[model samples]
Target: MTTQGENIAERIKAQAVSLGFAACGIARADAAPRTADRLAQWLSEGCHGDMIWMEERAGQRGAPQALWPEVRSVIMLGMSYAPSRDPLALERACDIGRISSYAQGQDYHDVVKKGLKALARWLVEEAGGELKVFVDTAPVMEKPLAEAAGLGWQGKHSNLVSRDHGSWLFLGAIYTTLELQTDRQGQDRCGSCDACQRACPTNAFPAPYRVDARRCISYLTIEHKGIIPEEFRAAIGNRIYGCDDCLAVCPWNKFASSAAVNKAFLARAELVAPKLADILDLDDAAFRTVFAGSPIKRIGRNRMVRNAAIAAGNSGNGAYREQLERLASDDSDVVRDSALWALQRLSDG
Candidate 1:
């Protein structure tokens, strides 16, 4: 060990907390054998679905050595992105849309990665070593690594859940050429709690600790390309972007906090529970204006409008037929098909 190794590690950890990460934990740049095998099995089971990229860096995801040959330690950090209110409550207000808590404000990738890079740069300058930072951008298995590092335990939904922040934390990792003291690993605390599994609108979790991304509403609205499967449409309700049912039902929110540093995390008053009728009227420009600087901007106008059309149809309100009918001729098959489905739901109702 170097003369100042412990001091360096302490400084790094302190600086991370100062940077507003709710919790920080470190692990040796080595693989946990059981976790490694489990990851391989998950890939083989094809649960990742349309996310082909998850398979690309399969080896590096589980083993830090696969990322950098000289990496001596892994520092995993968690920032509590938990909102002050429950996102699930909005679901019962079916006439209004329900955006996942994480997306209610700003895009986390930008904020979390920016903080990680700051800590990384500090390490290079103060510790005399090399470092790399990863947010959600790379092939990092952040949740597993964070769990191994002891920041939190993986809940039944397979997302990392902290006793402090619940399932509302965003995770990032830093790889370094310096050795650091590792944390005690946390155990699975899911117990008999199946709230996350039950809260899922589409039954995405076929079993505990496993999520079928193909059947997840978050996947359908955000990642999965092409028209969503017909069976999931009605169950999707008014969740246009992503679903947070699994995260919200965790019993840990009593200790969770509002993420104050990220000012953009404050929910946009209008977007939080926008009416399906009002959202469906947006053209491309209007959508851009409304969703600018938000994660929803990534999905574009038609996709969002298509979701609104479906929600309108499910609203059992016949007045929205004109708007839904106009979208039926849309060239984008996704929008057109959703319009057709909405029209049918409305007519039948």
Candidate 2:
């Protein structure tokens, strides 16, 4: 005989699938007890780099009940954004900028949150419970929660890796007052494979499951505010928006198919491999216009141009020298600084 809670859980998952969620799993509010301590340690070590928000809500982020006392269960959902082509294919194209697969399409924050709210409404009608939804904006430790909900385990790269979706799942959570049946926790299957660690251009992974975000190309390009450290600039190469080296190298991706990816996450043609010259030419207005409705818009023109300058320098193409010279006198200090460095690099060669 099946319990009422089990039936509700199954219905909730089916509803999530109908709403375009690639995966859905549930766990008790306090499923992952160690999440708090691990997060505390990671925060204490400054592994989050310049993202001060993580420290602001540390307590609430680690424990779901701490954030919402009424919450009894957590429902984790994943939307697959698996790339159609090799993410690292643009590496040899020195004059082109490689945008991370996730940001190449519509902003995931909007896409994932829309689905979450829809699912929350369906649950309210079906099970009659108070609920709250969250995406990456919240201080929530989504990967750990996903693991506790049996979606996948946090892999050696410190990213949730699904046997079915690989490392390309966009996570969202629904904390509810409903006491639903919970799923078993996901188990680690990484074994002795260290492919993710070996693929990092900047050695971002300090150990099997710990990532020092300070050394991560994605952090440097998108999160870190001021100038990027000199040591990692060359290693960043043509990747201006974000880096996917670690995620792309995971062996589990063999099971991920582009067919399973949501249409909202498909790569935009212009962003797949944009020319460095065009990116460097973007002023504030141009950048806003070009990236409208895209996640890359949040970084703004200054950071984007600064990143393009660095990639231009690494390109070793003399054709970019004039653009770099013009950008050297740009208004933003970071953009000017990066442009000057690129000019110097070109002059040296």
Residue pairs whose backbone atoms clash in candidate 1: none
Candidate 1 lDDT over 1-349, as tens digits, reads 5557767777877898888777888887773546668888888988888788888888877677776789888899887777777787877675787777777787788888888999998888887778888898786778878888888888889899988788878889998888777788877887898989888888899899889888998898888767888899999888888888888888987777664335546777876788887887888899999888788888898788877877877788788889888889987788889999999998887
Pick out the ten consecutive residues of candidate 2 with the lowest summed lDDT: 1-10
Please, what is the TM-score per model? 0.94, 0.98
Q: What's the CA error at residue 19 for candidate 1, in Å?
A: 1.9
Candidate 2 lands at a TM-score of: 0.98
- After superposing candidate 2 on the true structure, give the runs of residues whose Cα lies further than 4 Å from its correct spot: none
Whole-model lDDT, model 2:
0.93
Error of 1 at 188 (Å): 1.7
